[model samples]
Target: MTVLQSFPIPRPTTNPYLIMLGEALRRTPGVTVLNFSWKTALFGRYDVYHSHWPEILVGGRTPLRRLTRQALALMILIRLRLTRRPIVRTVHNVERPDGLTARESALLDVIDRQTTMRIRLNSTTRLPDGERFKTIPHGHYRDWFARYEPQEMQDGQIGYVGLIRRYKGVEGLVSAFRETEGRREGLTLRLGGNPSTSQLAASVASLADGDRRIELHLAYLSDAELVEIVTSSELVVLPYRFMHNSGGALAALSLNRPVLVPDNEVNRKLSDEVGSGWVHLFDGELTAESIITALDAAAVRADRPDLSARDWDRAGIEHADVYRAAIDAGHRR
Candidate 1:
């Protein structure tokens, strides 16, 4: 069984989740893995198509590029339907991406309708009516970063790393850290990752201005740099306005560091899965008190988060099972 992945294999800048999943799928018994390209997507031979971040297919930097990709996306959808190929889409985001054009939305609707199965990275994900789905915990990054030399963990160092976007609430994090008082003399906030826009970059910069305790690396972070950010921090805070399944949180845990995230059902469930004192949460809006409180909580935890459920080998087997089932059902349909 050949499974076509929507993303390419591991690269210096590839998302670690995709790289790990791709490697695991390749090792799975009776399964062959193929990385996606426009050519392979439209005309390649594969038994099951597994798509992650399908929106990327229709997104582009400019209007002309977007239009071209949207056309190809339409053609791909038509071919999949005509050939009766099954699509296994990973539900990475809870909703249709914000700021999508109407045509992109319609094309995504087609992809949703044609999907045979959806993979949820966490058990707490809620799908629309009548959508068939499976829960495959996003794999940990312990093995992925094993090659890098571990950075010495620093006390009172809180870090946030990954692509910085407005919805991620980086500015809020900076504000909270700035206002936090008492026992924070040793606390330093580290922010890393490229911003989505110049305005966002400036917003975070303005908030972080004159705060020597706050460090910003507003550029694409390589794997080694990411490892240093995660490993060195006593706690990693991801104050996203909306966070369902975060690779950042998992990466922090994989590196044996605790994390502070938004309080929600998904995060609550994650806390239970990982263990006590490993995943702390802040409710409502992120504030100075929440940041300080979560930091205090992370300081006392000495045990590692339990990530046995997220082993890449297990993820590979589970993905292969889903792919096989989707293929069988596709044939029947």
Candidate 2:
């Protein structure tokens, strides 16, 4: 079966999950991936259309470009319905992205109604009522960064990497770190990734004021640099305001580093799956005590986080099965 993915390979800003999934599908026995393009999406030959984040298709840097993309999105939606092609959307987030224009929201609503199957990264993800879905655990990053030289774990380093968005609560993380007793023990905080806005960067900087131990690499990190930041830390902290599933958390575990995240059913399941001392959870908002307690857990973690359940080969096969099932359902209809 041939599937057209809404992601481009070899794009510098492309997420590693998309890149790895494309490769996995290519390696599968009877599956083919038709890389996305405006020309391909509107006119190309493929069996099923696979969308990861459909919002990007209708967004642009300027109003004129945004309108143009929105027009294209509408055209593509019409073409998909006319051709009777099924769409498989991977549910990365349960909620519709915030800050969508009315037109964009309506377009996505149509896309959602037209969707054939939904792929959830975890079983705990609640779908819209009675939506047909399958749980395909997000794959590990162990194989993707295998070629990079590993960074030695630092004793008292706590690191946060990935896009610096307000919803991610980087400022809260810095504030909590500042209040931690670990600072007297030489515990350091490293912040990487470009901030979503200058104001957000300034806010975090203000929080880190006069603190020499708080290192900031407020820029986009290459794969090697991301690896260095994550692998070098004894503990990784992700203090998101809300998180059901995170590729960042999985990446840290895949690199054999423990993570501290908020306490929730998804995280509790992750902790149970990966084993003790790997996933430290805190109740309510992150605090100084949470950082110190999780850091202590990181200190004595004897074994690597178990990521055997996140194999890419298995993901590829499962994805193929989903595509086949969607096609068969289309035929029956």
Candidate 3:
């Protein structure tokens, strides 16, 4: 059987899910994983059509192109349905980060009604309730990121690394860092990553201006730069207003570095399940006082969560089982 994944295949990516899952899927017998595109999907030759982040399937700038992609998606759906193939969806986010348009909303409606199998990367994901939902934990970045010997932390350097977004509480982190600088001594806050927009970058830049206590690398960081940013930190702070899952937190843990995350079920669970005094928590209002308290409470540990539970080989077997079941479901239909 063949499965077409709705993500860039055979392409180098920092995303651990693709790197690890792709590695494992390649090893799975009788399963062919192919790169997906509207053109390739038009051929209608796959047993299973799997997609993560459905928005990407219909991503476009012009309304005409968007509509065209939507029509293509419908055609693919129709072909799959008529061929009795399984259509699987992985709900990576509760809603699109950039919100949705009328066409995007309609696309999701059809997909929700037609999808034969749904994989929830997190059980608490905000997708609509359905019997089609299948819970699967996200794969870890430990292997792909190449676990390296952690260097000694210098001057309580706290860091945040990943795509800088508006809702990610970058502003709040900056404010808290400034407040911390006022109270704490000899500490620096380093933020590295390309911002969501040049405007947002400018806003953050203005806020960070004249502050020697904070350092910003507002660009797409290379692997070596990412390593330095993560390993040199005493603690990695991800003060997201909310979250479903975070590869950033997992990456920090893989490096045996403690992480301070917002107090939510997903983050708290990561702390409880895979912690060696590394996960620190802060509740609503990530104020400087609260941030300092969590930072002070955090302690470096020799032990960390063994991320082997997220290995792709085991996940691949489970995925294969799901595919076989989906294929059977198709046969029944």
Candidate 4:
């Protein structure tokens, strides 16, 4: 079967998940994959259109451009529908990364209605439409990222890495860190990620205001820098208000660092499934004290689960199943 990705990538440079999955897919026997281009999509023949981030087509820096892109994407959707090809959207987040706007939400509703299949990273991921969605666990980064020896929990380092945005609960992290600073001696907080927007950068910077114990590197860090942060840290926090699944947590665990996350259903499922000393869940209003308690659990993690089941090879096989299922469903339609 031939599969066309919704977005074009000649090579996967950034997202390690994509890199790993693409490599696995390429290795899969009797499977052909094509990088997506609008013109190629129009003329190219394929059995399935698999999209990890369909929002990328519509999302932009400005509202006007975003709307314009959405209009063009709608036309593309219609073209795909006319071609009678199956569309598979991989649900990375239950909501948009930048927060779902009303217009964006409506656009997603259309996509949901038109979609033949929706692939979620985990079983606990909620679906807007239940008829077509299924879960395939996210592959770990152990094979992709540079392997580093795990460091001891010197000074109780608590780290957060990924794009900094309001939805990420950075304010809560800063406040919680400040509140815990007094009781936990030598506990340091380090946050590294490019802020989603310029205004978000300025606002979040103020939260760190001259705190010696807290270090803020609010820019995109290289892989080595990311490794340094994860390797040195005692534990990492997702700190998302709500998330379907997190590659960041997997990255931390791949480097042998435990993770703390909010007690949402998807997160809880990840905790139970990953079941290494990997996850420490927090309940009802995460405050400084709660974070401290979670850290204490991380401090004494003697056994961490080896998440070998979530490798790229397994993900690729699972994804193949989804694509074939979509093809079958399209035939039925």
For residues 1-333, what per-residue lDDT tens digits would candidate 1 score against the true structure?
A: 998899865677788788888889888899899998889989899888888888898999999999999999889888888888999999888887789989888888888889999999888888888888889999999998889997998988889999999889998999988987574678898899999999999999999999889899999998899999988998899999999889999988989899899999999998998888899999988888887888787777657888999988889999998998898888889
Per-candidate RMSD, Å:
1.6, 1.4, 2.0, 2.9
Tell me the TM-score of model 3. 0.93
TM-score of each: 0.95, 0.96, 0.93, 0.88
Comparing 3 and 4 by TM-score, which wins?
3
| Candidate with the larger lDDT of 1 and 3 | 1
List candidate 2 stretches off by more than 4 Å. 181-184
TM match of model 4 to true structure: 0.88
lDDT of 2 by residue, 1-333 (tens): 899999865587888899999999999999989899999999899999999899998888899999999999899989988888899999998787889999888888888988999999998998879787889999999999898988998888999999999889899999999987544587899889899999998998899998888999998999899899998998899999888979999988988999999899999999999988899998888998898889886777657888888999999999999999888766666
Model 3 scores what on Cα lDDT? 0.78
Clashing pairs in 2: none
Write one digit per residue (lDDT tens) for candidate 4, span 120-160.
Answer: 78887677645777777788888666555455655588898
Model 3 C-alpha lDDT per residue in residues 1-333, reported as the tens digit of each score:
788887765554446576677678778887788877777787847788787778766667888888888888888877777787777887777776466788787877777676787777776776655556677788776766675555677657888998999878888899888887658888898899999899999998989999998999999887667778988887888889887778888878877678888888887777767755778888886788866766676654556666766777878877777777778887888
Point to the candidate with the largest TM-score: 2
Q: In candidate 3, which residue pairs clash?
A: none
Model 2 per-residue lDDT at 118: 93
In candidate 3, stretches whose alpha carbon ends up further than 4 angstroms from where it belongs are 10-14, 97-99, 126-129, 147-150
